[model samples]
Target chain A: MSSLSRTTFASLIFGFSFLYLPLIFTAIFAFSDAELAGVWTHFSLKWFKAILNDEDLLIATFTSIRIAGISATVSIILGTLAAAATMNTPRGKYDGYNFLKRIILLPIMIPEIITGFSILMLFMVIESMFGWPKERGILVVAAGHSVASVAYVYATVSSSLASLDQSMGESAINLGAKPIHVFFHITVPLSWRAIVSGWFLAFILSFDDLVIASFLTGPGTSTLPIVIFSNIRVGVTPTINAFVTVFVVITIILASIVYFRTLCLKGRRKGRSATR
Target chain B: MSKKVVGFFLFITLLIVILQWKVKDDYSGEVVNVYGWYGIIPREIFNDFEKETGIKVRYDFYDNNEMLEAKLLSTNNGYDIVFPSFIPYASRQLLMGIYSKLNRKLIPNIKNIDGIITSKFGANGGDVQFLVPLFWGTIGIAYNKKVVSQLLPGETIDSYDVLFDLSKISKLFPYGVSFPEEYIDILPQTRKFLQLKHGGESVTDFQECFRFLEKVRPYITKFSSTTMISDLLSGDVCIAIGASDNAYRAMRSSKAVDKDIQYTLPKKTGILWIDCLGVPKKAPNKRNAYLLINYLLSPEVAAKITNHSGILVNLPAALPLINAEIVTKKDICQSDPEVLEGLTMGCARAENTRELIKAWSQYKTNTHHTSINKEASK
Candidate 1:
């Protein structure tokens, strides 16, 4: 066997074990009624019952879904349009394009606490000035996440756009089809996979966020991860483990589909692919 | 193959979505929600109270008081019975007003309170009620005797001074001691020591605590809240200092397994903390809360909790009923020694706490590098 294939196989085994071993422990502990994690004398589903009935956690979960959905939609719209514009340009031609990309990435790159603090201060100042208080509710949190998520979506869509045969659009144009028509029919339909995956990817990033959400979230509007974090600060109970197992399973499945689909798409495209 | 896989994925996705959406919290009646810390308190006490008075008790716990305090400070927190650290309760005015109007007639055991604690909560010139002091304890170090014996010079280590004194113990804890990175416990110790050495004031903010924590920074192997107690018992650590109750836990757990564990009472105790119960001003089940407080004050319930939790309760009746075996064994760290040793008295003195807090913050800042379990100390 080639060294490349062997190295790849070894790393895959190591990485999967590293990630899922603890998750498996969490899953195991979720079935038990032991007060402490160490000695497990009994197995019970009581914790799952508590988690399912928890009002605050349920509210936080709903809040996360709503916020994630809104953020993803807004981010993908801006990201796809930006990708559509940027993909055709030769890499070095636009002098300030790199700077624009950096600006878009500032939310994701800087320390989250710093970003959170700055936005909170900015919100405070705006409220004081306008007397509008501009409501730092779920809407503001969604906007904050969208700003960060745009970079991911932009990266995903632009690469997918670049993979398209440039001649296909030109050929359609040559046949007297309008440019907008060519884009809507030919380009969008073909790239829906990337766009949909990017949207889901953005959704996960936004949903899982805690630090930014904690600061930006107004009274009674925290997301699920924030609630989970608050609960964890007290203690780790099997109930929380149950809730988290569900999250783990859901995310793993979503991530697996996203991963394999990209692999298949890239296999077909050949030149550029997500490294996974 | 692909169609079936895709169909299965869609089915699971829809199930999760529906499950998450369908799980909603509907509140009807007869329950007073509580947020507190987990300890030796039994559910039977709460159940008995519920049976006598028809108010159901739903309890939740925070690892430390800060998280609870933060939640209480939020506008919409609906907790009716909030158990906060005595110092934390002292730091805020949120509960003071609610306490001022408690009907003493309903709680016949109110007379059983030790005079000192009663004075702490009782009315002044007017009816200014503070929290009913339920449990009180001193901060000290709890250690595994086996590990600490190894640290002793010629097997003789016995004191807190043996901990930080480099001359007597050159490399006893090369990888520092295990203590939580918290403002309440560590910051105060740093403040007291730094003041003794450098004569600085107290601190209250994160920046100040950063400086405070930095002084003892190198001595800290790792700062953890709840982990330090179990780790010390399991022999992963030589010694850890914070609350005596956790030390009592280590001692009791060892006794259960027939191992020697020692929790040393320091020459000068860092802080005296009290955990108290109070009903919110807007408690839906105020009668139930009153009945529960009365029930907790009962001799049997109080003795069981104080014995199991290793915290000293204020009830005079409860004190006599506690198992003499535990107290005599020093399985519990006593506050009388703490008072005799002159614990900094940080829990009281509300007017002066801000400055103390400021100094405490500075001390924590000093030990910031080793800070992780900031809430653990509380």
Candidate 2:
């Protein structure tokens, strides 16, 4: 191989290993039989079995998943609409539109601790005034996560939407397609990849969030990260590693399926183009 | 594709609806929400409480006292019960009126609390009407026997001298000597060691502690509280000034790794740390909170907690029921009245806390090595 190709190959290996070595070690140690989490002993599935009986961990994991799902979906919907509204507006037509765009990005720019504290204050004010959300719980946590995640989704979707040929939607509208149909069929279809990536980004953000969730969490609303963090002072059990390994395996399986599905879709598109 | 996306979203909505339904189901019965340190209470105890009283226990956890204090200080925090450390947090929060007065009539089992722990907490301005001193531990020296013996042969690892003494700590510097992260944990012991007046509110008392800490700062390898247990077990630190429960855990785990780990309260000065169980002023289910507290104070449950977690529950009756290994461990479950009597509870004064923190940070970041260099010049 040429030196350029050799350098490229070396960098690729370096990058991938750097990203994955810690995960690989965590996976390996999950199966160790030792009492100490870091120690390596003979391979055992006891920790996995231990997870089966840990009701609190299971509940926390379920709560985390539910919050992530709700937040990701809500953020994606709100974000896509925000992106469309902001991007479709004529430049300098509305001064408030520019301010609105900046306001939407504020959650991303500001520190999370400040955001968490302010959201907590907001909840307390709302509780005192309206007394509707009488107690903070899953709904409050999900709402906080959604507020934080919407900025990320907006950033991802708008950048992809900006690169799109606007003329395609305009032409479709001219060809007897209504504006709603044009948006759904043309704009959304073109930008769905960015939307999917954005959803994943939002999902991960909500899933691993500790600061905001801690502030908003009430009785029986502890998320997985909160539960794991609370266990850190007392060293975390190997069951957590076992749980992570299970999570990693599931994520890998889902990713490969998505990867193969996209590959197949690309192959089908190429064949259709060649036939045409 | 739109249909698939719609289907996925519908599935997520359905899952959320089901989860919300499940969460709502919990409130149908009498419920008490408890927030405390993680891994301290065994799950079996909660289950038993529920079975006996038919009041479900919804337990949450915070790793540190600051988080608990923040939640408590907030209006309508919705926690029926919370465990805050006695000194500084519980005492400070008590003064803030975040905790409600306990209905002693509801909790008849309050008599079971060990007197020694109670008096120590009371002396430190902890009030039984507001806070129940349920869990207690000591701050002391945890050292790896093999490493320490090799480094300083024939040296007894009992006192804070293993940590604060310049000559002794300098010897253990290469093997690693870690101090406590919190100023409250080490400063009181430092005061006791230096024979400074405990009640002296002067900034000079803090200055004296820092002056001593500054001399030995370079020899100290790291300042951490949470990582002490693992650091000892992994041989990362041969000596650490930390909580007794963490040291006990390290000692227990060390046996498996073929390493001897020991914890000792200094003969001259041992600091007692207490976690107070209190009901929030705005608790939603105060009645159920009382029931849960009464249940936990029972000997069987309290013993189970100590046996499982190695944290000493402040119930003297539970001592006999605890594991023989833990009950026998002098440094951990201190049965001796003399040792318990000598223990000083450390509390940071509210007005001088900022000054103490400033001095602590200054000592932590001071890297000039002025004392050592001056000695070398001499």
Candidate 3:
């Protein structure tokens, strides 16, 4: 048993190293003095300073974050509602709930380039017909990202909803609780963890998107990924390394806080249930 | 509060913010979108232009001429001024009536342009009003001098022969050569050397061009449009077939670390590419666009662009203001009168572009297999 556990641990170490070694090298290169990452002349923070001073990059980052936050929130709300409605539909009825599920997940099934191009064409047609969205900007990017993120949110929320005891909700309704009150008071408290996880997953998907954002963005509204990609043609500058390192650090901190808080809450709930 | 109530509040807050938050234009004043290749326009130039004219210059980049063409075809994208190379891309667009005629009266600084510069676009520019010449240079070889000397002692650095006849030098630097990935740039030089070898009469069709590329494809280790300089600096590639600006940049970058990166034009003749600025027909800010063009044509601005971008500026007035190191170097400027006689300039409409694109795709697929097989063997 000990030997088997050792072998398993070794393989896990190897697997994780393969995944994260490049990011480690990137972080090291972010602080390197030379233009190329091969040389290690000394430590430097000039690239970080350069990134701060670059107005274009800052504006793009702001646009990316703003779009990601809005899109993720929108996706979570719509996805949870859709998932709840689909779950409530009787399994044998097949009364268009199945169709609704398939259509809602269609954007994720389609290739990203196709999705981006189709959304762009749709916006173009709408613009021509009704003069809506006269200009392509961050809002169009949010719309595209939200559409793509919805499926992930729906999958997570609906899977958790399916595992829950429907009898609990029925009992709450029977005890004179209104449908809305039961949903808010009973159903939501039970699936809160999955809902939060889905929100974060959607957030990541929207935040890291490049292809869809590229099609939807127009003049004066470049995203961080777009700017970084364009600048890379001049050869890989350390500024992008610095920018990515900062992004990674923020993500780690936020994820850590969420993970620990969830762990603590779960532990406290277990203790409460044991006492009961 | 219940988690559901909190989630509802967060969702509502986000909706309100997204709906209320607008994508404010970065520039408040008159704006002109200048689309070109990456790093073609330096930041200082934009700031200076904006300060001088109060017309905010919004710059964007596309990796290839095809993307630019697609964008232009798809939308009246509100781009005022665009900078593009003459042949293959812009020339094709010119034929389609995509570019607007310039109002010469507004651009008084056009007088500063040399005859050679004006004529470089077309036969007396075909229609001088269509585009203004920005910078011009020859496409040639950027090679590591030490590597070349050891490869072939007593051989002169000039000639497309070293690149085309790679079988002879394969032993010296096996799998050392690289070419730009773009066929638009590659085909012109490939055809030039092919004509030089087989005479103009023998080299007739796109098949011949494709054939030459195939013959030399094996010796090429990498075909990358960017990273030409970094590749040289890292010693991954000893020689690259690239345009003047990149070649100059590579040489400068390598020299900073005491590496002797040398650039040479083909001995007797070479292919020339001229980057020009033209306004789109539906440009909204026509007056500001003209002002920007005229300002760019001014000797100081022209000279700054040349020095910074490392392309040859043809404005004679700006010649004195250019970096002396570049203006003085023969390989960089290519000003030899006798050698000038041998140079072949690219045409406005070189050939059936569809055929050219097809041949290029075939070459790429063939090369891809060749490289894969070679890699597997190794």
Candidate 4:
């Protein structure tokens, strides 16, 4: 039994090391002085300085942030509403609820490149008909990103809704509360954490997207992932390593804050229960 | 919390509207949208162009020719200037009626362009009105001399057999060969190498190219478009068939890290490629596009582009301004016309391209399975 346990432990370590070793190497190389990527001659911070001064990269980063924020927000609102609609409607009352759910989740099923190209075609048709969107710019990119993100948000929020007690909303409605009020006061509050998590997930998906972003990107609207991808294609420069490092740092900070806040909330809930 | 979230959403909506308005206004300015290969042009040139012409240059990049073609065909691509390789795609684009004629009157600097460039394009149905030559280079074998020297003492590295003669070189360094992943770049070289070996066939022969490609498929450890230079520098692959400019750049970069790498033009034949700048049809900023082109053509700007890109430029006036060391490097500066002796320039192969690409794909798939089987047996 001891031997089996030790072997399993060793395999676990091997698996995780295989997964994270590249990321560790990337972080280490971000500070390496070498240009051609093999041996570290000396430690340096010049790559970070180079990243800060790269106007195009900075602009791309800003564009990505803007698109991710807007797309995530749009996903949250639309996903929450869709989840509410499905949860409220009776199976027989809405004859096509399952079909609607599948349609809503279709973006997740379809390959991203196909979705990107299709969205591009859709936007082009809409532009031809209405002449509203003068060009394929940020709004179009945001819409393209939101298409993929909505499914993610919907999946998370709907799962949370499915797990919730059915009688809560019913009891609220029976206690002389309006249906809309019950939805706002009960359904939303209970599912708020899931919605927030879904929003963050959508944000990351839109942020990290390269294929869809490439198709939807137009003049002056190149995103971070697209720029990094093209630059890395030629060669892996130290500046790209620095960019990845910064991205990793940001992700870590965000994750830590969320983790600590959740811990605190849980602790507070425990204390309230103890008092009761 | 809900109210705060709503307010934040409203604020973001307002910000997006403002940004969109600004983007629309940017088009009215003297902005030239230049699409070209990534890392080909230095950023300083764009800054200098903006300073001189007051035309803001927004540069975008693509790795392959197909992407550029797709962009040109798409509605409202908004690119004013596109730098596509002169052969095949440019000519194909011309046939498609997607490109606009250059206003030679606006570009008085056209006179500064070398006659060799203009005449070559003119002979090949590339009118000066349609394309302005940007940079030109050749595709050849890039090798590590230290490794190749031990394999064959006193033998010159000028021939493609340094890569193709697998039994001789592969035993010396197993899996020491790498070819390009792109069919377009590798196919031309394959045709030329096989022609040199098998003695003169049509440049468009699918069976011949595939024969050589399949013969070499097992010897090559990887088909790399992106990581070829790195592999060569690391002494992983002794020989790589790549562009002269890329090979030269890798050699220069390796010097900084104390790695020995060198590039050699094939002794008998090589594929010559020239990338040209042109304005696409219905370009919103044609006037600024012309200004930017003429600016790029100017001797000083052209010299800087040549120096930084490590590729030869066609502006005769820029020649005097180019660094003496750079001009002497045969790979970058093949100014003499005599050097064009056995070089085959890529032309519009629209007829054979589809079939050749298909055959190559099938060959590659077969080779991939064989390689997998060999690995499994090992």
Q: In DockQ terms, which candidate is top? A: 2
Tell me the tens digit of each residue's lDDT in model 2 across B281-341.
8999999999899988999988999998999999989888999888778887776888888
Question: Cα lDDT for residue A257, model 3?
Answer: 100
Worst 10 residues of 2 chain B by lDDT: B368-377
Model 2, CA-based lDDT: 0.85
User: Which candidate do you rate higher for lDDT, 1 or 4?
Assistant: 4
Question: TM per model?
Answer: 0.62, 0.94, 0.88, 0.90
Stretches > 4 Å off in candidate 2: A1-4, A90-99, A171-178, A271-276, B367-378
Chain A vs. true chain A, TM-score per candidate? 0.80, 0.92, 0.89, 0.92
DockQ of each: 0.08, 0.58, 0.41, 0.41
Q: What's the ranking of the predictions by DockQ, best on top?
A: 2, 3, 4, 1
lDDT per residue (tens digit) for residues A1-276 in model 2:
565687799998899999999999898889988766787768899999989988789888988987898888889989988998887655678889889989999899988888898999999999889996878887889899999999999999999988988788768767899877866776677788898899999999999999999999988888999999988899867888899999999999999999999999999999999999
When 1 and 4 are scored with DockQ, the better candidate is: 4
lDDT (tens digit, per residue) of candidate 1 on B12-60: 4664455335422213356666666554465566777778777767654
Candidate 1's residue-wise lDDT over A95-194, tens digit each?
A: 7876876676565678777876676677667776875443455667887888778888988887899899878887888899987776667766667778
Cα error of candidate 2 at position A115, Å: 1.2
Off-target runs (Cα >4 Å) in candidate 3 are A1-6, A37-42, A168-190, A263-276, B1-8, B11-29, B124-127, B172-175, B196-203, B256-258, B312-314, B336-342, B347-351, B367-378
Per-candidate local distance difference test: 0.63, 0.85, 0.74, 0.77
DockQ of 3: 0.41
* Model 4 Cα interface RMS deviation (Å): 2.7
Give the better candidate number (1 or 3) by DockQ. 3
